[model samples]
Target chain A: MTREGWTRLGLVAAGIAALEALCRTKVIKPLTLVPPSRMVHDLAGLLIAGDIFDDIGQTAIEVGGAFFLAIVLGVLMGAAIQATPRLRRAVAPVLASWYAVPSFVFYPLLVALFGLSTSPLIAIGVLSATPAMVVATIGGLDRVPRVLLRAARIHRLTAAQTLWLITLPSALPSLFTGLKLSFAYAFIGVIAGEFILSGGGIGYGIAYAYESFETPKMYALMLLVLIVAVGVNGALHAWEGRLLQRRQR
Target chain B: MTRLFDSLAIVAGILLLWTGVFEYAGDSAITGPLQTFRFAANLLGRADFWQHAQATLSAFGYALAISAVAGIALGLILGLHRFSGDVAEPMLASLYTIPKVTLYPLMLLVFGLGVSAKVAFGVIHGMIPVILFTLSAVKNIPQVLLRTAKALHLTPMQTATHLLAPAVLPEIISGLRIGFALTFLGVLIGEMFASQRGLGFLIINGINSHDVKRTTAVILIVITASVAANGALLALDRRAHH
Candidate 1:
């Protein structure tokens, strides 16, 4: 990163170009190995037509909606459980078991319950991410200094003040980590659900392409999804970095 | 007694929700927990479920065999040769970060939606995680361990056997456990996309036919497998600790 970023980028670019060349050489069947150039053409076409962009927008909305739901619900639930020991003892194992259940198992159930609409996709994402958020929130809260807790009690700070001043600030970094992970869960959860339910998604487009024998378009859609994923992941990292900076100062 | 009571209460509460919904709803797919369990029992008794499971499990085995050998070998190369890490780690990470389902079409095109495609898919899913984790494990070994091996006039193979391998065995096992789950997931997705038989196929079949119970059954099987896998992994981790 420090030494000539463009050179490193060019090396990576060249490697991809070489693979593209190998694919286009026709030594292997064109259908079997889509050249990078063809893939780029497909991508450019999709971008121009704007259907792919719409799918990307819908996916982002679902992911963002579910991520928001997980943060709010998970943090509140975590705090409630943490405030009450009996609740923690009663809920932790149950939550842990549910967490271990792959969210895909519920994708069909969600579709059955809510139909093939965005609800099912978003619902699965929420369910998948909430446990991670909840678990991390509790850990984050527990890591807050015991001295601070004692001092807060002694000062008789209001619940609102304690939450904002003591708990939230102390737990900020872990909270961000939890949210980062939740975003990741949301991404996979939405994709898997949409893939199964077969409508209004890049997943649906992918299945459509496969069934319709548009392999090049299928690969292009997947590339677009990957680009979106990397972008989202990078954003999450930057967000986490900001949180870390806040902690440092 | 408290533990049992707590667990029972939780189960009862969950069952209560399912039954309440089942009773109130008009001919919905969400059956009572008891009824679902009964159906699960019936499904379990059927040979078809096991056959589908076997199809999926077999693909997992082939993939595991490929990945374990190749990944560990690659990991060793990168771990022992510092230059490999410098040049290859980012390359590997880039591939690793690529969601890999993107390559599903490529595999299908070449392997034609068969068990071979599924195996290749599984290998792609599992190998990178194993390699990266194993590399870290090897890299984190005490320099003293390697120096001791050298002082004892250990050959490279002998050093790998006694020094590097033993040091990273726990991580290697950790990687394998994750690799197993990933292989299962990959094989399932491959089967789902295009395949003849597997739990994924059954689920897909159920979806296409609008057979909710059959679809839910496949989903349940996947959940059970995941729980069993996680439990087994935890047991392995405990064993390693001991």
Candidate 2:
């Protein structure tokens, strides 16, 4: 690891240690926060007891469905827009300002349309996630080298062959960024939807715990979310780095 | 110009889509675009509606102010220090990706159920983007410029005001635009979950009470306001970049 990495780790450790000390000394108050160690311990107990497995499974399915749909739809939409110059010109400003609107405001409308099932959660997830993928797709497509297209034409390649061999490979990095963003947005959307309105999932569990004054359980759930999010992001970052390195070579 | 016509066309397309959705989904799910606009206009006319809007606006204002000032200050420090910036950047990025909704309970507990909690939530959401943008902007400043400043023996304040501030203005504006949206989002989410006032609360309350028209109208108003604000900022951003 790099020196900066080590420094960051040290800083994190020191911060956690400080929190633990404060909790142990009764300065932070047990009602407000538990020690990090206790939170981890409680999380392990919950996992061993299989108490949250159903919630985890439900969240996973919703997130997976949303992520899959967003990627497929976003890529299609992006490609379609790219193909039509007039449509792209009209749609560009809308897409640019899309995120400015708080999309969560539409969750109730979705719930009313789809009923209070995982469908609303998944729909919201797709709504939030798809735009990132679409933006990335457009960016990637825009950056594809004209020289590569020229080479493909000189080789008498079919249109599909040019797209497959030249366009796709050239656009892979940006598409991967889209994938990462889509996952993050999907995860956030589904969890937030569940948190605000739904009757099930990890988000609901945390809200329940909080409302019932189960501080330890709430913290445990929070810790689980943090770990999963950070772990997935780190994996993607490492994979992207390797992929880019190989491309450079 | 063609651009104005294209924009008008897009608006027409959106209204058509909304009408189509209303026709398919029926009255229970959504309002017709025309009805929604009429309802929204009525809402704008009501003094009580402005109270909720004011509540939201005030919280948003505080959050944006705190986020911009703190983010720029912290970003400047980190950007000037290469190792610290390297250490902090990834951590901040990871935090950005995480589901921060999970921390709402903690914010509520710490700040209690009020505007302070809302402001705190907004700051957390909005500040990071500003910090990241400002950091990169500062880091990307020409080394020659810094060397030139050093050669001239300009005071620190003079160097910052005359050199660093102008150089980073465009990127900072871009960041502020993003921060504005996010802080607005954060404030609304905060209202939706805990508060008794604000347009977010009104939307949620309307849904709970089965007032679909009110909910739809409020959403339409909020979306229109945010998009218009973003459009204005975007224009400024483009001008700054040029």
- Per-residue lDDT tens digits for candidate 2, residues A1-249, read 989989999999999999999999999988888999999999999999999999999999999999999999999999898878888989999888988988888887788778899999999999999999998999899889999999999999999999998999899899988988898889999999998889899999999998898989999999998898888888988899898898889
Q: What is the TM-score of chain A alone in each candidate?
A: 0.87, 0.96
The model with the greatest TM-score is 2
- Candidate 2 regions exceeding 4 Å error are A158-161, B151-153
Provide the lDDT at A65 for model 1.
91
lDDT of candidates 1 onward, in order: 0.77, 0.92
lDDT of 1 by residue, B1-242 (tens): 88789879987897787677566642345556656677888998999789988998899889989888899888877887775565666556555445566556677788886899889888987898789878878878999998899899999989878777778988878777767677777777788876999887887787777776677666766877776776677578558755
B-chain TM-score for every candidate = 0.87, 0.98
Q: Which ten residues in a row have the lowest lDDT in candidate 1 chain B?
A: B25-34
